[model samples]
Target chain A: MDKTVNQKAWFLVLPVFLVVAFSAVLPLMTVVNYSMQDTFGNNQFFWNGVGWFKELLDPSTDLGGRFLASLGRNLFFSLVILAIEVPLGIVVALSMPRQGWTVAACLVILALPLLIPWNVVGTIWQIFGRPDIGLLGYVLNHIGIDYNYVSNEIDAWVTVIVMDVWHWTSLVALLCYAGLKSIPEAYYQAAQIDGASRWAVFKAIQLPKMNRVLLIAVLLRFMDSFMIYTEPFVVTGGGPGNSTTFVSIELVKIALGQFDLGKAAALSLVYNLIILIVCWIFYTVMTNASAERKPQEGAA
Target chain B: MARIDLVDLAHSYGGNDAPQDSFALKPVTMTWRQGGAYALLGPSGCGKTTLLNVISGIITPSRGKILFDGEDITPLSTQKRNIAQVFQFPVIYDTMTVGQNLAFPLKNRGVPKAEIDKRVAEIGRLLDLEPYLNRKATRLTADAKQKISLGRGLVRSDVAAVLFDEPLTVIDPELKWQLRSKLKALHRELDLTMIYVTHDQTEALTFADTVVVMHDGRVVQSGTPAELFDKPAHTFVGYFIGSPGMNIIPAEVRGREAKVGDHVIALNRSYDKLPDGAKIEIGVRPEFVEVVAPAPGLLSAKIERVDDLGRIRFARARLGDAKLAARAPAGFTSPDGTAGLKFDPSHVHVYADSLLVEGAA
Candidate 1:
């Protein structure tokens, strides 16, 4: 048997390649150029020969040490957000009604928070967590607890985490609800015939079936939490010390706050590399886990 | 094995209604014997599925008593009813192996591991799925997945009944015949009370020993296939069960005969009382209608169209304002112009106000 191959299909993708090269590749090349060179004012540049990268790798320097610390903090925050949000979102989704006008009402309400601007979300939470006047901080302080997000690093971290949950938990819930709704009613009927308890039904049927969507939710939450900046920066401003200074905040302070352009460029490159590596690990683990299972056709 | 009895069952989606919007399924009383294969045959939106859901306890009836082996189970949950149902589409878990999918219910019930394995093997063998046991269920073809669904239902022997809700609708035409026969064989082997629901007459007639014909939220007729074919108690039953359906031509009842247009056909049986001004209809199956040359016969017809279905020939002819279908053998020939149609008096049925008149031929 002979096979026919089409080579002209590459023409259709040429425009997309050009667009990506102009938008993404060009800017990335500029960043790489800046990272490798030391610049004084008036555009005079000299090759630093990996000098900034070396210093950033050394733990004694402020840049290297602070970068490592913030990286650890970002990882911790992403893990905590995933741990709390995924299951809570699933629970909320499962409790939603299957049909009716109430389902539409619930969906609209859940989507409202996601539609708000990210910067506005940061500002709103900033005022909402104030110790003296804010509703949450006032209640906690009234109950004989000291809650000051500005001065305390732990409080800042907690406030940022809570704000994240409030802002992004609805996304996970909506995805889960869509997954649950896509499930055929026959599964429920089969479960009932099997005399499965509510928990058993959820474990065997609901959870396993929502695996694909749950992977999506986890990856989205992980990436978003890792790149988190607006809300935490607005609330903490990198904190009273180095405690709540995540990678993004530290990168911003180096690049713009201190105007150390060459080092900032090197730090930004390292930051991007970290995110890329972590995201690649997450994608690899998830895909490997999925591939280990039997290859079921038509799952998508 | 247990008999299921539905007493005074009625279901309404909302509260008490007006005359037109009262109930989806009117109050019904029926009993299904153990080890019997039954079918609920009806058109779309005829409430056959609603009645089946009520029996399965998926939907609680507004007013009814459901008895399984003399035990009240009306208020019981579906899980408590112990009834297995195969739905319109295949619903097997995509992530599990064929063996694991079949073994799920048994595992949920905490059956011994060995017993569960044995039962899964048995069901897999019955379904011709033994070779694919290790394969994920969703990887199989549509028909194969449906067989897995069927096997999942048939895996458990302790269930009270197995219900099929148009389970073969998604199956290919050639596979439907094979699966239907397999189900019949399974019913005979297991002696489980199986209730199959479908709007297809061929499936109902071939699979069920007792076919329950439903129309407009009511059970029009419930009897053996032969009984339903030979003697349909209602006009709807006569119209629904046969291929080409039954020819229901409006007629007027005179002493011992029915008048169709200007021709009067003699009846073989007598009715005690034919109600005054009651609209009557004469029903005759296509098989019983004989076509002959236009002679001085009981009725005259013009041959309109002839349909040859390989083995049988169907001649649709016009008799005055009414059209009648006549079935003949494959080699039977008829002229295209005018043809005379005659009906055997004994095969004719007289219906008044949709109900079959007693002792009417």
Candidate 2:
């Protein structure tokens, strides 16, 4: 018997390789180069040789101080956003009807916010939350509440959190809705026959079925919240006294605001490393949970 | 086990002019005996599932009273009705182990831990799922998952009834026969009331003691399989129950005989009370029809097609404007040209205006 084979299929992957090399690898190499050396205005450089790393890791240094603070802030923000958005999204998804033009209308409305650019979201919120002319602030002041987001640290933090929720909660809701829709009607009938309460049905059938999509929602929200910059930058300018200064905002301050090339490079690398490690941990944990419950690979 | 009674039960999806357009289930009044296995058999869109759902309290009848053991249960929810249902596809929790899935209802009802374990083990054994008890349900094959679904429904022994809605449709042919027999044995052992709904005539006839033949949203006849075959209450039942169904030949009733195109067939009993000018049809099971070599018979037909189903050969022929089918033993052959057909007067059924005449046979 003769075997038939096609080796020319390698050509199909060439364009993908070139695109990744140009887009991802090139920028990554530049960041790696910047992290190792100190440069002055005259295009002359000095071998820092991990000097920036030592400074950033040292407990006594200002860079170290900002690094720890921003890391804590970012972690807190991501956790809060996940805690709020996931449940809220699930509630919204469940309340939506299962059929007809209404479902289409709800989906279109939910997706509208996701289509807006991040910078535009930030700009819109910045203007919308103004103390003097903005409708929200005007209504609040008329209702006799001293609502000043720009000057109050707590208010700024609250505003940023709320903005993030409004901008991204739909993503989690949409994912959950898709998961819910994919569930077979048979499961619901079974639950009905089992005399399962509404809560039991949701806990046993809906939640377990939505696990894969929920993991995606969590990881996406975590990574995006960790690297969030444009919205907070446009709204608070990392202000109300560094209260809303997340890691990304701090990295920009060190790189462009202070012109500390060596230190900024080290800080940026550290930030990237933190994200990669956390994301890896999240992925590993979720994948293991799902795989452990996956039915045996093959059975008759 | 308790007997269920449905009184004046009718359901309509939306109000419309014609009955078919409005009501999925026409008004039905019937009583199901305790611990009896019953089947609602019909083709698709014949309202079998709708009737089953109404009995299970999943769909409330628009006009009816449902009584379980002489108590009105029309207003009760499905959970309150204490009925277990098995669906067309398996409905097991994929994340839970097979043992856990079986134990879920008992646990929810606060059954003692020891009792739960014993019940789960028994059900697992019953379903041949003991080997996969510790394995997660999602990893099992489709058939295995369906077995788990069946186990879940059967685990709670104190439930009022067990309803199956085409539950074996997803199983492969070989496995379907296996599981169906298993279900029959389980019903005998448990002595539980079981109502199975299926469009397949074989499944209905083989599994249930009493087969409820339904058509166009109403129950036409409910009786033993033999009764449905030998003495159908309605013309629809005569045409719907058998293989190739029963041959319905259009005829004009004259006194005590039925007149086909050019010949008259004698009826064993007379229906002189039938209204004048009433259009009628003669019904005969394919098994009772005899094909002869131009003997003194009622009508002559040309053979159209022949179907050989191993043990039996069914010959389809046309008589005048009506089609007739006859079943004979495997080796029976049809002649080359026109064939004479004769029906036993004792087996002949006379229908007037789509309804069986009172005294005609």
Candidate 3:
């Protein structure tokens, strides 16, 4: 058999490369350029030579302080979101209707929040948590609890977290539901024959079967919550006094609000790198752990 | 171990108002003796699995009572019934080691740790799974995982019965024989009432002492291997149990005689007073019918083809408009594509409406 040395295959890949360069590489290059340079008004630019990166890293500097605070806030928010969503998602998935028309109905309801645009979700929650007008706000206020998001830091954080949870927990639930559905009916029958209790079935069968999807859910939820901006931005506007401000919101504030292009570009690069590193770690650790049980998890 | 009795047991997935044909399992009354290895033999959709599930209490019958050693267990849940069922597909806790998978049932039932360990070890050795006991079950091949599933079922010593639902479907062809023999040995060592459900005739025949043949949601015959081969109670069983099956042809019957078209064949015993307007058919296995030179007073047939199966040979021949297979003697040849069929009268059976008719001696 003669092996054909084909250079024509490279031409087929050309279109994809051009599309990626236009859609992603070009914009990222611009950010990289801006990160290394300072920009003056009148569309003028000059080399800054890592000055913005230095300022961004130093906690004593204004840019660095804001960046660290928001990074900590983002990490904390992601942790809390994951802690609440994964278990809650599994529980919700377990309770989902196994069959009939009701299954479609329940799936639709679970998917409703995920289908909404992020900005729309933010806007909805912003109005919904208002002290005077919104249903949730009005009800909470009528119950005699002191709850005002605008004036109180904890209230603002709570509202933003709840809003994010309400917006994204469906994503986790839907993923887990798909995982649970992939399990064959025979597993349940076997579990019953084994004299397994509800919890034992979950621990032994359901949870193990859901392993791959839960890893996916955790990674997706972690990355998404870490980069969350629109909902919190609309609901709290980074107040009560920056308490609800996350990394993405702070980056937007620097670039658009303050016109600190150098600082913002540097922050953007760092933020992207952080998400990348965390996701890489997650993928590596998870794939390695599941590799011992490779063939079964593919059913997911 | 316990004897299981299905007293008028029936099931229909479509509810009570559904028509008779819609019943997944037609009304069945049977008793399975304790410690007997039984095989529920049938093709797919023949209600073998449904019957097995009913026995295991995984499915509750729509009507009638199930008895475990004379105690009604019709309404009992599978977990409470103390019945172990291995499914068609191997179901193992993927995260657990093979030993842990075996121990899961005992652990779930709050068995003492020492007892669980001893049983797990015993089952491991029985299935030759000792080396793989500490290995994750998910890493094993389909055959080994099936062993783990079987081990889990056998781990519980107090279970009344063990039901296997086509458990070898995923096993490799070469390994099937080994696993099957292992299961037979386990049944003997454990002495549990084991009911194996399989669509494969070879698997069913080799695995069970008594094979229960089912067809179209009914138990056609439940008898020993020899009985099933020699006297299948239904035409379906006769056709289903053997390779190339029994040759059945429409015939006109009278006392001590049956006619295939104008060709008369002698019956050892008289099948007189057969039901009126019933479909009368004569069934005889190829092993019982001999293909020979065309002769007088014998059914004449045109030899269509010869199938030499190494050990035995069968001649496919046409009698009038119906085709039949009959045993061809060693070094046999038909010079003019014509042959005569000689049936062993005692081995021949008469069927009416697909059910076998017992002839009067």
Interface RMSD of each: 2.9, 2.6, 2.7
Cand. 2 TM to true fold: 0.91
Ranking by TM-score: 3, 1, 2
**lDDT (0 to 1) per candidate:** 0.85, 0.85, 0.90
Worst 10 residues of 1 chain B by lDDT: B13-22
Q: Give the number of the best model, judged by lDDT.
A: 3
Candidate 3, lDDT over the whole model? 0.90
Candidate number with greatest DockQ:
3
Over A214-269, each residue of candidate 2 has an lDDT whose tens digit, in order, gives 99999999899999999999999998889889999999998899877777889999
Candidate topping TM-score? 3
Model 1 / residue B272 / CA error / Å = 4.7
Return model 3's CA RMSD, one decimal.
Answer: 2.4
- Residue-wise C-alpha lDDT for candidate 1, range B1-361, written one tens digit per residue: 7899989888887743635346888878999999999999999989899998988888888887999999999989987787888888888876689998899888888889999889999999988999999987767877788788878777786888989999888788998998999999989988999999999998998999999998888888999999898889998898788877788899987667888887888888876588888888988899888877667855877888888877788888887777879975455565557767778888898899888887744
Model 2 chain B, poorest ten-residue lDDT window? Answer: B13-22
Say which docking band candidate 1 falls in.
Answer: acceptable
**lDDT measured at residue A17 in model 1 versus the true structure, 0 to 100:** 96
Please list the residue runs of candidate 1 whose C-alpha ends up more than 4 Å from where it truly belongs after superposition. A1-22, A277-300, B16-21, B328-336
State the RMSD for candidate 1: 3.6
Q: What's the TM-score of every candidate structure?
A: 0.92, 0.91, 0.95
- DockQ of each candidate's interface versus the true one? 0.48, 0.54, 0.61
